[model samples]
Target: MPGIRFSAQDLAATRFTCSRLREVVAGVQVLKDAGARAIHLPWVRQARAALAGVRYELLSQLVPMPARYLPDFLSPMPAATAPSLAAELAALTATAPAAVRAQLERLPRPLPALVADLRRDPAAGLGRLAGEIQAFWTAAVEPHWPRIEHLIDGEILYRARRMATGGPAALFDGLHPKVSWQDDRLTIAQRRRTADLVLEAGRGLVLVPSVFIWPGAAFEADDSRHQPGLVYPPRGVATLWEQGAAAPPQALAALLGRGRAQLLAELAAPASTSELAARTGQSAPNVAHHLAVLRAAGLLARHRTGRTVLYVRTAVAQALVEGGG
Candidate 1:
């Protein structure tokens, strides 16, 4: 079992951010797993076909095992509230040669020639790797990013509410079956490794929510070089790739007309017009039209977060959904 002992300062400094780099890294593991562990994620199966032509052989070799050690430099912590994929690729490209060499050296089966080239001209080596990552993302992730982002955003929202209402203990509770909270310590159960981390005040812990890191949580706390953090599967991930529209109740459909009612029912959680369209198998224009009607009718409300507009059910909408059901 790996446990992190949090100090008062670490608790105070703890924060959450969704990482595009992490998602890409985890996707590598998913691809290597060959859909065994991620059997429930239909998107993973779809991604495999999409990424067949990508030159991901190197990444696949790097992450042969899911729960094993992965090079830390591959997925650094996000530097912004919602870091874009391009920004993350740039971060990888900017990684110091020494750091890249260090991580490459740590690989169980190091590629001697690749390591030599990276150490010789770190910028060029890392630049090529970053380009590969960008290609991988385009083939395997960009298409499904809206749904992925919604899952991550929903998890962050839930964690915020937990922390606000129940403090750290409440938020940590049930984060994962293997995770336990007591005595200001966060313990993560690991299959073949164990460590105790004592966090310092200024260092702080970063809580990252991952959609693909299922079944177990990962902890990274090595010296002062990288911020201590845990990457755990977010809540409600079981339905991440569950297909088909959320069918509206007959009563609600009759009352609002089928298209509008279906849109409202799908808005049980916050979603953008594009996300709604993708999930409900409707066109974006059609979804936007229904959303406008619902908003005008007081059944939906839109909130702007960053560059995207997310629509959520209002109190009346929730009541109607429940009553109609």
Candidate 2:
């Protein structure tokens, strides 16, 4: 996608900040909670763990030198034209280097331009954006292969294969997630187990790539049209960081509006749920329940400052209210 508006230098200054990084971490936690059921948390956990081994390399590839060069290269495209970009990406991938070619091919077939356009307009080209992103990353960034191939190949790719397929076959067995494609409306037993766990945990879901969890899972539309990897979350996570506001009546509205707003106003600083309830004249149980929900949703987080759990609103929560997401 076109880069966000920061200059190369400014972009370089932007390390994935606490706000963004925390969202990812929170999402991971929620996913783990959900995966406890037949959903298979181990698979997702393994995928994330594998990522740690190569995250530095992946980050380097994403945040390259010539600092702003990458973002500047893609800033002007209109969002609506993302599909066209996807088409461009698909064409480019036709000749990607062998090592990266396979990765590029696994992406949903879409235009790179279209994906880049998302930086300008997130919802513009919804259909093939993910594939286009995969293609673009492989083509634009894969050439500068860091010495992290062993991790990517041995860990990331290995875990991804396990998630896509169903077994931990020997590496030489050639059984891999990238090579597995289920087209018959089937469900993996492991995935179901994991999902059960997540629901029981009472949180949102985050899908990660692992030995038994497929990060590339896509779904067809009501009309039964085939959409590639990235089926859930309707819109990719990038949408939360893009221009327009998210679909409203958000996951945390109960704790962010005027009523809750009053409760927050009463607190000079962090306060316990019981304290908030007393000030707001709401029952402690109700207040506590809302607090837990907000914390799980990333709108708020709890920390132990003393003898009580202190609740604090997160920046993302404020941004969402301001229509910045």
Candidate 3:
């Protein structure tokens, strides 16, 4: 149980954003745990096969099962609200050896050979780790990044909307069962809490909503160099890998072609072209073509969340789906 005292300046600086690399990291956490398999079965089946050929011996050792404390270098606070995986990887590889050694020594050992190697020659080891992560990114995360990005962006927007009317209390309230905010202090229910970052100026709390780390939350803190962040599961975790919605109404399908109508029906939540393709069993080109046509017809609207574009149903499309007009 640790309380983060946030001064007025800190509150002003607090921002909500999503991380692509964080999702990749969290996916690893999910893949390693058996208990998470049932809810994430769709992804588990796919991710396991994709990851089988990747060289991640060191990467796996860095984030051990029952992950407690991970090296901050694994996911440094992204300078960009939406950093490309390459950028995040560069940051990881650039981690000061002193910092790498410090974090690794803290982990309970016997350290795996790869992890121990990182401490000995961090520059070389991290390069290999980054390469492993890149291979992993291609297999497990890149395929679903659009959907993951959409989900994270939507959650941030939802929290922003809540804060607008309900105030900060609402923004954090029920964010996670283990988190609470009051008296200009944000509290995280974690085993260890340090307040060094709280006293620093201009470094606000960074909020990151994640998908694979559902049922738990992670808090990160360090000196001014690293931004303090909290990574928690987003609200729509259950639907991330869900198949398409049920059949679109026949009347709507007649008005709009069957393919387009089906796409519209599955978009009660905003989604990317890739996401729609995965859920609906359509090709990327086909889904992209349909989304463009739908946007022109005013049945859908697009919003850019970081690097990904999300298409949500417009008012007209909503009425059409609900049998209104």
Q: Encode model 2's per-residue lDDT on 119-206: one tens digit a residue.
A: 3343333223334344433443233222111112223333333444643222113223323223211232222123211111112112
Off by over 4 Å in 3: 194-199, 246-269, 272-325
- Alpha-carbon local distance difference test for all models: 0.77, 0.33, 0.81
Ranking by TM-score: 3, 1, 2
RMSD values for the candidates in order, in angstroms, are 4.2, 21.4, 4.8
Q: Candidate 3's residue-wise lDDT over 1-325, tens digit each?
A: 5777787777778887677778777778888884754678788899888887787887888888888778888888777777788888888887889989988877888988888888899999999989988888898889887677788777776677678778778899989988998877788878776542354666778888888778889888753586788889887677777775547888998988888998988876677887788788889999999999999999987878757788877767989999922
Better of 1 and 2 by TM-score: 1
Give the RMSD in angstroms, all C-alphas superposed, for model 2: 21.4
Between the candidate structures 1 and 2, which one is better when assessed by lDDT?
1
- The true-versus-predicted C-alpha distance at residue 239 of model 2, in Å, is 35
Best by lDDT: 3
TM-score of each: 0.78, 0.21, 0.79
lDDT of each residue in 182-252, candidate 1, tens digit only: 97888888654466777776677888888777756777764356687788988757667767788999999
Cα-lDDT of candidate 3: 0.81
Candidate 3 backbone clash number: 0
Clashing pairs for model 1 are: none
What's the true lDDT of residue 200 in model 3? 69
